[model samples]
Target chain A: MAIPFSYSLRNLWTRRLTTVLTASGMALVVFVFAATLMLAEGLRKTLVETGSYDNVVVIRKSANSEVQSGVDRAQASIIESQPEVARGTDGRLLLAKELVVLINIPKRESNKPANVVIRGISPASLLLRPQVRLSEGRMPRPGSAEVIAGKSIARRFKGGGIGETLRFGMRDWTVVGIFDAGTTGFSSEIWGDVDQLMQAFRRPAYSSVSFKLQDVTAFDQFKKRVEGDPRLTVEAKRETRYYEDQSEAMAKFLRIMGITLTVIFSLGAVIGAMITMYAAVANRVVEIGTLRALGFQKMSILAAFVMESLLLGLLGGVAGLSGASFMQLITISTMNWQTFSELAFSFTLTLDILWKSLLFSVGMGFVGGVLPAFRAARMNIVEALRSS
Target chain B: MGMGNGKPPIVEIAHLSKSYRRGSQTIPVLEDITFDIADGEFLALMGPSGSGKSTLLNLIAGIDKADEGTIRVGGVDITSLSERELAAWRAANVGFIFQFYNLMPVLTAFENVELPLLLTGLSRNERREHVELALQLVGLSDRVDHYPAQLSGGQQQRVAIARAVVSDPAILVADEPTGDLDRVSAGEILQLMDRLVREFDKTIIMVTHDPRAAEKARIIRHLEKGILTDSDGQPASPVAGS
Candidate 1:
C-alpha cells in the first residue's frame, strides 16, 4: 500500500532549516531563469504592440526597417490612392508618409551618447496609431520646427523635456509635447513635422508609407497588387508582421543569452538539491526502516522522498517568480540591434512565463531527487533497522 | 510439526536458513532453524548479542528472505512469494514493534497509530475508529494528540504497540521491544504484550536477551551459533515467573 501524502509533507516540515536552505538555492536559479525569460518577452512585446493588425506598411523592397526604406512622393501618392486604403473622417486617405533617421543624444545621468530614432511624420500619423496619447502640451503643428518626444526619451535624455530646445539637423528644434506610447517601440522615438525635417535634412525621400486597410482580409490581394505594380518599387506588409519582424533578431538573441546563463546556473542549483536529498536519506535511515517494517513498500518510500523534493521545488518556484514580478516596475534601456537605436522597455511577466517557470522548477526537483530516492528505496530493511 | 492445541499454525517454518555476505566472506546468521507458532500464542526467542534471534524474527515477519527453506504463513508459502507480493502480504498480515519505540517523531501518537491503516482500503472514519480503539486498548487514549518526545518511555512503547496492532494483522513480530527501556517500563510493556495475547487473541513473536521478557511468553526458545539451542529443536516450556 502507498504511504499517505502527509507523510512526505510533514517530513519536509520536520526539517525546516534544510528545506529553506535548499529551496533558497533553487529559488535563486529560478529567479535567474524567470528574469531572463521576462526580459526577452518584454522586448518582444514592446515591438509587437507598436503595430495595428488592420494597417499595412509600404516600404522599399530591399529595406528591413523604416530607417532603411525610402519612398518618393510619387510612390507615396500612388500607394495612398489604392481603393483598398481606408479613408479618414475628414474624407482624406488615412496614410502617413514618414521619414525616419538616426541621431546621437546624451543621457541625463551618464552623459554617454547613444543612437536615438528621429521620425518625421504627417498629421495622419496620430490618426493611424491610436495607442499613442499626448501626455503633456500639444502636438507639433504642421509646417513648423517644433518636435515632440516620447515619454521614455523625455525622461532619460538631455533637452528632451517639453518646451526644451534640442539642436539637431543643423537647426534648433523646440520640444513642444511629450507623448506616451504604452509599452511600444514608439516610446523610444522623437517625432517632428515631415516637411520641415525633409527640408532641414535635404535630398531625402520619405522613409515609409503606413495606411489603414479598408478590409483587413484583403491584405493578400493588396500585397499582390502593390508588389506587381510597375510604377512602385515597394513591398506591402501588415503592420503587425512588420513590427514582429523588427523585434525578432533582438528577442532571439536575448532568449539565447538568457537560456545559456540559466543552464549554467541551474547545474549548481540541481547539485545543491541533490546533496540536500542525499543528506535527508542518510538522516532518515532508521525512520525508513521503521516504515518498511510497518509494511510500507520500497516504491512508497521512493515516492515519499520524491514528494519531499517536489515540495522543495514548489516552494522555490513560487519564491523565484514572486521576485521576478517586482522587476516589472524597473525600466531598462539597451541597444536595439534591428534599428541600431537605444530602446527602453520594462521586464514583463506573462501567464505563459509563470507556468513555464514553475514547471522548470519542478523539473529540477525531479532530476535532483531521482538518484537519492532510488538509494532510499533500494535500502535493506535489516540494515536500515539496524542503524539507530 | 503440529502443536498440542490442534489449531493450525499462524506461522510455520521448516528447514529455514539464512546467511549474510560481508565483502566476500559468507557469515551464517541463521542455519536450519525451524519452528511453528500456533494461533493466539505469545512466543519469545532469546540469545546473547549476534546470535541471530532478530534475523529469525525478521524472516518470519517477511522482512527478509530465507535461503534454504519454506515458510508457510496463513496457508501460503511466503518463501515462494516475490518481493512485491511479499510486501503486499506483509502489509496485510504482519504487524511490527521495535526496541527504540520507533514512532515517527513528526506524527502525533494518534497519527502514528493511524499510519499502517493508510495502506488499507478502509475509509478515513473507519481508520480513525480503529486507531482510537488501539490507543484505548493501550490505555493512552488521552495521549493521542501528544508527540512521542512528550511521552515517557513506557508511554512511547505503548504508543508503538498501539501502532503495531492498529491494523489488526494476523501476526505481530517484535525485535527487542524493551531493550532500551528501564526495568519498570520494560515490565509494563511485557504486561501489555501478555494482555494482547490474552484479550485480543494476538500471535506475537519477540526477540530479546531479557529473562523477564521470556517469562511473559507461553513458549520460549534460545538461539546460539545461528541455530536453535533446544536439543530436539522444539520450543522449551514457558519459564516460571518470579
Candidate 2:
C-alpha cells in the first residue's frame, strides 16, 4: 500500500529551510532554460508572422534573401503579367516591385550605429501587406524623398520619428509617417517610394517582385511556371515559407546555446536535490523504521521520499516559470543573421513552453530523488530502529 | 503450565536461533529458544545488556528473521513466510510500541495513530472513527491535533499505546516502552498496557530492564547470554509464571 500524500508534503514543510534552498537552485536553472526557449520562440514568431501565405516572392535563384536578389524591370513586368496575380478594386495588379537594402543608423538610446532594413516600395506595397497599418501621421507622398518608419524604428532609432530628417545615400529623406506592424519583422524597417530610393541609391534593378495570388491553391502551378521560364533566373516561394527560412539559422543558434547552458546548470541543481534528499533520509531513519514496524512496505518508504523530491521540483518549476514570464514584457533587439539587420522582438511564452518547462522540472526531481529513495527503502528495519 | 482460561497459546516458538556477523566474528544472540504465550497474556522479558532480550523481542515482532526455527502465531507458520508476506502478516497481526514512542514528529497524534490504517482498505471516515476511538481510550482525544513535540513524554507514550491498539492486532510487542520516561510516566504506561490485556484481551510481549516494569506483567522470563532463564538464573521452564 502507498503512503499518504500528506506524509511527504508535511516532511518537506518540516525541513522548509533546506527545501527552499534546493528548490531555488532548481528554479534558477529552469528560469534560464525557459527564458532561452522563449527568446527563440519570439524571434521565430516575429519573422514567421511577417509574411502572408497568399503572397509570393520572386527572387534570384541563387539568392537566400531579398537584399541579395535582383530582378530587372523586364522580369518584374513578366511576373506581374501572370494570369494568377490578383487584381485590385481599381483593376490594377496587386504587385510591388520592391528594393531592399541595409543602411547604418544610430540607435536613439545608445547612439551606436546598427544596420537597419530600408525597403523601397511601390504604391501597392502597403495594400499587399495588410498587417502594416499606418498607426500615426500620414503616408509618405509618392516620388518625394519622404519615408515611413515602423513603430519600432520610430521609437528606437535617431531621425526616425515623424517629421525628422535622415541623410542617407547622398540625399536627405523625411520621416513622414509611423506604421505599426504588430509583432512582425516589418516593425524593424523603413519604407519609401521605390523609384526615388532606387535613384538615390543608384541601384540597377529591383531586389524582388511580390504579388498576391488570384487563388491561393494555384501557388504550385505558378511556382512551376516562374521557375521554368527560360528568360528569368528566379525562384518563387510563398512569402510565409520565405520568412520562416529567415528565422531558422538564428533560432537554431539560440536553442543550442540555451540547451548547453541549461544542461550545465541543471547538473548542479540535480546534485543539490540529491544532497537535500540524502539528508532527509538520514534524518528520518527512525521514523522510517517506525513506519515499517507499523506495516508500511519498503516500496512505500521509497515512494514517500520520491514524492517529496517531486514536490520540490514542482516548486522550482513554478518559481522559474514566473521569472521567465516577465521577459515577455521587455522587448529586446538582436541581429537577424539572414539579413544582417537589427530585429526587435519580445519574448513569447506559449502553452507549449509552459508544459515543457514543468515536465523538465519534474524530471529533474525524479533523477535527483531516485537513488536516495532507494537507499531509504533498502535500509534494514532492525538496524534503522537500533540506530535511533 | 496451565493457561488461566484453558485456551491454547497464541504464539508458539521452537528451536529459534539467530546470530550476527561483524567482520568475520560470529556472535550468537539466541539459540534453541522455545516458548509459548497464552491468549490475552501479558509477558515481560528482562535481562542485562546484550542478553538477547531485545533480539528475542524483535524476532517475536517479525522485524527480524531467525537463522533457523519455526514460529507460529495465530495458527500460521510465520517463519516460513517470505519477507513480503511476513510484512503483510505483521501489519495484520502485530502492533509495536517503542521506548521513545517513535511518533513521526511531522504528524499530529491523530495522523500518527491513523498511519497503520492507511495500509488497510478502510474508508477515510472509518479510519477517522477508529483513530478517534483509540485516542479517547487513551484519554488524549483533546490532544489529537498536537504534534509529538507539543505533548509531554507521558502523553506521547499514551499516544503510542493508542496507536498500537488502534488496529486491534493479535499481538503487541513493546521494547522498553518506559525506558525513556520518568517513574510516574512509566507507571502510567505500564497501567495502560495492563488495562489493554485485562479489558481488550491483547497478547503483549515486552522487553525491559526495569524490574518494576516486569512486575506489571503476569508472566516474567529472564535471558542470559543468549539463553532463557529464570530470575534465579536457572534454565527457564517451558512456561514461566503460570
Candidate 3:
C-alpha cells in the first residue's frame, strides 16, 4: 500500500532547520547549473540569431571568421552579378560588401578601454536585415564621417550614444544614431559606410560579400557553380550555419564549465544532505521502531525518508531558479572568443532551464538520501524500541 | 492438553527457542519456551531485564524470527511466512504500542492515528471516519490537530493507543505501555487497555516489569532465564505438550 504524501511533507517540516540547510546547499548547486546553461544559451543566441537561413556569405577559401577573411572589391562585384543571386524590385542583385574589425573603445564606467567590434557596410546592408531599426536618431548618410552604434554598445562605451563624437585611428567620427537589430548578433557592433571605413583603416579589400539566395533549395547549384569556376577561389556558406559555427566553441566551453562546476558543488551538497538525513534517522530510531511495530513494512520506511529528502530538493530548486531570474536585469559584457571582441549579453532564463534545474535538484536528493534511508529501514525493531 | 475438543488455540508456539550470537558462542535469550493463547484472551508477560519478555513480544509481533520451532497465530504458521507476508499479516491482525509513546513527531494526533489505516484499501472518507472513531475512543478528539511535542506524555500515549487499534486488528501487543508515565497517566492507560479487553473483546498481550500493570490482566505468566513458570513459580506445561 502507498503511504500518503503528507507523511513525507510532515517529516520534513518537523525538522525544519535541517530541511532548510540542506535545501540551501542544493540551491547553490542548482544555481551554478542554471548559470552554465544560461551562458551557453547566450553564446548560441548571439551567433545563431545574427543571420538568415536564405542568405549566403562568400569568404576567402580556408578563412573561418569574417575578421580573418578578405576578398577584393572586384570579386565582390562578380559574386553580386551571379545569376543565382536574388534580385530586388529595382532589377539589381541584393548584395553588400562588408568589413569587420575589432577596435578598443573606452568604457563610461571604468574608463578602461575594451575591444568592441566595428562593422562597415553599404546602404544595402539595412535592406538585407530588415529587423535592424534606428531607435534614437537618423541613419548615417553614405560617404559621411558618421556612425551608428548598437543599443547595447551605446549604453556601455563613452561617446557611443547618438550625437556623441568618438575617435578611431586619427579621425573623429560622430555617433549619428542608435539602432537595434532585433536581438541579432549585430546588436553589439558599431556600423559605418564601407568605403569610408575602408579608407580610414587603410584597407583596400573587402572582408566578405553577403548576398540573399533565390531560395534555400538553390544553394547546392549555386555552390557547385561558384566552386567549379577556376577564376574564383572562395567558399560559400549559408549565413546561419556560418554564424552557428562561430559560436560552437564558446558554447561548448560554457557547457563544460557549467557541468563541471555543478557536479563539484552537488557533491558537497549531497554530502550535506546525507549528513542531515542520517541525523534525522538516528534521532527517530524509536519512531521508526514504532512504525515497524504498527505494521509499516521496511520498504515503506525507506520510501518515507527518501521522499522527505526529495521535498527538500524541490524547495531548493525553486529558490535557486527564482534567484537566477533576477540576473536578467543586469547586462554583462564579456569577450566573444571567436571574434576576440566584447559582446554584451543578459541572463536569459527560459522555462526549460528552470525545469531542468529542478530535475537536477531532485536527482541530488535521491543520491543523498538513499543510503541513510536504507539503514533506517534495516534497523532491528526490538533494539530500536529498547533505545528509549 | 489443547483447549476445547480439537480446535487449535488462536496462537500456538512449539519449542520456540531464540538465541543471540555473541561472536562464536550462542547466548540463549528464549530457550525451549512454549505457550498458547486462546482467542480473545488477555495475557500478561512479566519478567526481569534478561528474562526475554520483550523478545517474546517481538517474536509474536513478527518483528523478529525465532531460532527454532513453529508459531501459529490466527490459525496461520507465522514462523514460516516470508518477511513481506509477515508484514502484511501483522498489518491485518496485530497492533502494537510502546512505553516511549513513539508517535511520529511530524504528524498531528489525528494523522498519527490514521497511519495504520493507510495499509488498508479503505477510501479517504472511510479512512477519515475510522480515524475519527479511534481518536474519539481514546478521548483525544480535542487534541487531534496537536503535534507530539505539543501534547503531554499521557496524551501522546493515548494517541499511540488510538493508532494501535485504529485498523481494528485482532490482537494488541503493548510493550510497557505505561512504563514512562506517572501513576495517574499510567492508570489512565491501563484503564483504557482494560476497556479494550472487556468491552471491545480484543485479545491483548502486554510485556511489563510493573506487577501493578500485570495485575489487571486475566492471566499472568512469568519468565526467568528463558524459562516460563506460573505465578507461584511452578513449572507450567510446555506449549508443545499442550
Q: Which candidate number would show the highest DockQ if scored against the true structure? A: 2
Residue-wise lDDT of candidate 1 within B1-242, one digit each (tens)? 44634566878788888999999999999887667778888888888788988889888998899999888888889889988888878878998999998888888999999988988899989999999999999999999899999999899999999988998899999998989999999999999999999988999999988888988988777788787765245543321110
- Rank all candidate structures by their DockQ, best first, as comma-separated numbers: 2, 3, 1
Error of 1 at A139 (Å): 2.2
Query: Residue-wise lDDT of candidate 2 within A1-388, one digit each (tens)?
Result: 8888999999899889999999999999999999999999999999999999999999999899998999999999899889999999999889999999999999999999999999999988999999999998898888888999999999999999999998798899999999999999999999999999999999989999999999999999999988999999999999999999999999899999998999899999999999999999999999998888888889999999999999999999999999999999999999999999999998999999999999989989988999999999988999999998
Candidate 3: list runs displaced more than 4 Å: B1-8, B239-242
Q: CA lDDT, every prediction?
A: 0.89, 0.92, 0.86
Prediction 3 global C-alpha lDDT: 0.86
Q: Against the true structure, whose TM-score is highest?
A: 2
Candidate 2 local lDDT, B48-129, one digit each (tens):
9999999999888888999998888989998888888888888889999998999999889999999888878899999999
Full candidate order by lDDT, most accurate first:
2, 1, 3
Query: Candidates 1 and 2: which is better by lDDT?
Result: 2
TM-score ranking, best first = 2, 1, 3
- Superposed model 1: Cα runs more than 4 Å off: B1-6, B231-242
Better of 1 and 3 by lDDT: 1
Q: Pick the candidate with the highest lDDT.
A: 2
Q: Taking the true A–B contacts (Cα pairs closer than 8 Å), what share appears in each candidate?
A: 0.68, 0.74, 0.82
